[model samples]
Target: MEVKNKVIWITGASSGIGKSLALLAGQKGARLILSGRNTARLIEVQNALPNPECAHILPMDLGDIESLQECVRQALGFFDGIDILVNNAGISQRSLIADTHMEVYERLIQVNYLGTVALSKALLPHFTEAQSGHFVVVTSLMGKFGSPWRSGYCGAKHALHGFFDVLRMEHQKDNIAVTLVCPGFVNTDVARNALTGDGSAQTRQDQATARGMDPGRFAQKMLRAIEKRKMEVYIGGKEVSGVYMKRFFPRLLHKLVLRSKVV
Candidate 1:
């Protein structure tokens, strides 16, 4: 679908891929509702938009699931109806599974999986009534092929595939589209904001992430997928082939994954 003049709500819009998408959508003449955890950073993004008047800032924390409905309501009050909802707000993980605490897993699921589902459910009725809406989910390649030191993050992203797969089938009659986007490591602040076992943000970015694709380029690719209304899209460097490897050679792929440079 053409994005121009469409009202889109993108979470995690303060920086990285979300920020890039918001600015690109603005240039495409789309009205935007940009959300993120940091109010100051979100406002900074809004300030940089070429069409700032078309972008609305909404500071949100998926952890606060209970209040998300109110947040959605406030966002909706500004526009007629959202043409697309980009479920991009999520936390990353780093640490061996054995070393990870139960609390860490709980927080990861709460933010990455449960919160995303809750917000989608809350918005379901509106989409059903309108009979025209799209859900663009930004899960990781980890969701398809797991790597080391991110047990909880992998699990949460994996869950989204199952849940959204079912949702796509169930809601097809309603004209509600679900596009699951699985991205490989892209150069972004995600690594810096990843949570450690102790629930603190990791201060340093990973080496691989620092050298990953530019956020602007990634966003351009993603917009094409959205425009094509693709059911799923896997994006990344050659490592992205690991997904196909797993499908064709599970046992051998498992061994290869065990020795992956990502670890």
Candidate 2:
């Protein structure tokens, strides 16, 4: 569907892929609600948009699950209705499972998986009433294949796939669509901001992430997938191949991941 005049609510809109998506969608004439934890940065993104007046900033902390229903209420009030909800607000992990604290795992699951699920659930009735809506989820390649030092991250992402798939199946009659966008690796602060064993930000970029696909380019492809209402789409460079390899050649993928030393 064309984004022109559509009301799109994007979480994690302060930077990275979410920021890029906001810019592109704004240029395409879509009304936007930009949500993230950083109110200042969200404002920066809004001003950067081609049509700042078409955008509204809704600061949110995804881990604050109890407030999501109220957040959704406020979001729907922005445009009277929302055509798409992009579940892109999430955190990353970069520590070995053994070394990672239990708090780190809880934070990962809360922010990356349960947060998205709660926000979506809160907005379900709106979609059902309208009989038309789209849920775009930004998971990761790790969701489909395992890699070292990201056990918790992988688990959270994998759970997104399972939950959203069932959401799609159950809501088909309601005409609500779900699109799972699995990104391999995109040039972003994901690595630098990733949580360590003690639940602290790593604050250092990894070489692979530093050399990943451009965020703008990735956002363009993602928007195309959303417009087509694809059930699932993988974006990024050659790392995307791992998804297929894991499906057909699990042993080979396993060996390659082990050799990569992904820390």
Candidate 3:
């Protein structure tokens, strides 16, 4: 559907892909409710929008699952209604399973999977009543295939696919759409912000991630997929081929990932 005049709520809007999506969607004339943990950064994004008046800042921590229902309530109040909810707030992993702490896994699951599910569930009745809404999930290619140094990240992302796929099946009658946008790798602070062995931020960029697709370019592709209401779309460079390789040539994909400099 055309995004012009649509009310779009985007999570993790402070920077990276979410920030790009918010800016582009605003430029397209979509009203926005930008949510993130950083209030200052969220305000910065708001001011950067083409029509700042059309955008609202709602700072939230996705990892705090209990607050999401209230957060959704506040978000809906911003625009009276929401046409799309983009689940883009998530963390990445950059540690081996053997060294990673269980707390790290829990944090990843809380923010990346359960938090998204809870927020979506809280907004379900609204979408049901409207009989029209879209759920844009920014999952990762890791959700589809495994890679070294990202076991927890992979697990959490994979769970999102399972949950959202079922959600689509159950909510189709409500005229609700689900679009799972799987990004292979994008030039973002994801690596730098990734959780390491003890649940601390890695604070360093990965070589592969440094050369990934631009966040703006990736956002453009993602918005197109959302407009088309695609069930799923993978965005990235050559790493995108890994999805097919994992499906048609699992052994080869496994070998390739093992050989690659994942970090």
Superposition TM-score, candidate 2 onto the true structure: 0.99
RMSD of each: 0.9, 0.6, 0.6
Worst 10 residues of 1 by lDDT: 254-263
**Runs of candidate 1 exceeding 4 Å displacement:** none
Residue pairs with backbone atoms closer than 3 Å in model 2 (clashes): none
Backbone collisions counted per model: 0, 0, 0
- Could you give candidate 3's per-residue lDDT for residues 1-263 as a string of tens digits? 88999999999999999999999999999999999999999999999998899999998999898999999989989879999999999999999999998999999999999999999999999999999999999999999999999999999999999999999999999999999999987999999999999999999999999999999999999999999999999999999999999989999999999999999
- Model 2: lDDT equals 0.95
Per-residue lDDT tens digits for candidate 1, residues 55-162, read 888888998999899887888877978989999999998888877889999999999999999988888889999998999999999999888888899999999999
Candidate 1, residue 33: lDDT? 96
lDDT of each: 0.90, 0.95, 0.95
How high is the lDDT of residue 259 in model 3? Answer: 96
Better of 1 and 2 by TM-score: 2
Which ten contiguous residues of candidate 2 have the minimum total lDDT? 254-263
Q: List the residue pairs that clash in candidate 3.
A: none
